[model samples]
Target: MDLVRIGDKVISRHKIDSFLTEILQLRSMGLSQTDVAARLGIDRTLVSRLENMGELRKGKSVAVIGFPIANRDEIYALMQAEGVDYVMLMSESERWDFVRQKSGIELFNAIMELIALAHSYDQVVVIGSGKRIKIIRAALDKEVVGLEIGESPIQEDKYVDPAELVAVIRAIKGGNV
Candidate 1:
């Protein structure tokens, strides 16, 4: 077996490569920059820098809009960890109640504000059912990556796969899609 000694310890280059692969996997799994840093005994800023390095464009801005997601909070956390500039994530019950309980100008203003906010981003990743995706795309009138997850008004919160979403984002960001 061959080993290289950089200082006091000897290690295989394969081991270093393997460790790097794990770190990237953990990152893909939606672990926060801080959590990855803690796990790797590295600075959190370094993790942030590594993520920024993969960003397709600087200052182009990305946003996420999803609803009725069962794992809304976790998905939101993942978006933040991935460096999305804006997010409007809500569970099914929360979104329904928001509209159902409001009336007159109250509802109108809220709806308008949300739409206005959604239009601010350069690219928006819309996660919803086939039906909702159509509506969202019509309203936003911007670059959208519509990720359909069946149909909605669903009773259960949809559990989104972080890795799948990450792949779509990477493709969009890298201009591959």
Candidate 2:
């Protein structure tokens, strides 16, 4: 990598590339075009053009992942009505059985698969406790809308309001939540 010197300052192509990559990543993570441009000392139009140029997937797709849901049927039905693309809902026993059924490698692969599937969607709706919600958000590292049912070490299913979840999903899908 050759560093170009201008007066007392040095400019690097690698550094520029890294900066652009960071800006693009931030945009992908849901930053506004104007914010990204301001952060990087670039034009907002350029940011918009860059995003349009890089878009590989179009439209908003949503994925819902939850466990130990008390109103599973109601929530699932509402999600179905909302036209959710991917839905993964499990009870406590079902979650235990799922984990116990998989070996180490299988579990790892399954987790990766889930992550990959979640990444494909524009938004991921996670329904779980606070701790698990944070973990999912960090793992997905995208636009995650968490539905906190309760705290960790959960012993009972949390009752969810279907209408409330639908409204939240609607807001998220509309890019307001």
- The residue ranges of model 2 lying beyond 4 angstroms of the native Cα positions read 1-59
lDDT of 1 at 85: 87
| Model 2 superposed RMSD (Cα) | 9.9
Instruction: lDDT for model 2, please.
Output: 0.82
Best by TM-score: 2
> Please, what are the lDDT tens digits per residue for candidate 1 over residues 1-177?
657987898989888678767777897777988898999999989877765655544237788888778788888888888778898888878988888998979999998888889888777888889788888878877546777766765566787888888877766666544
List runs of model 1 lying over 4 Å from the truth: 1-59
lDDT of 1: 0.78
lDDT of each: 0.78, 0.82
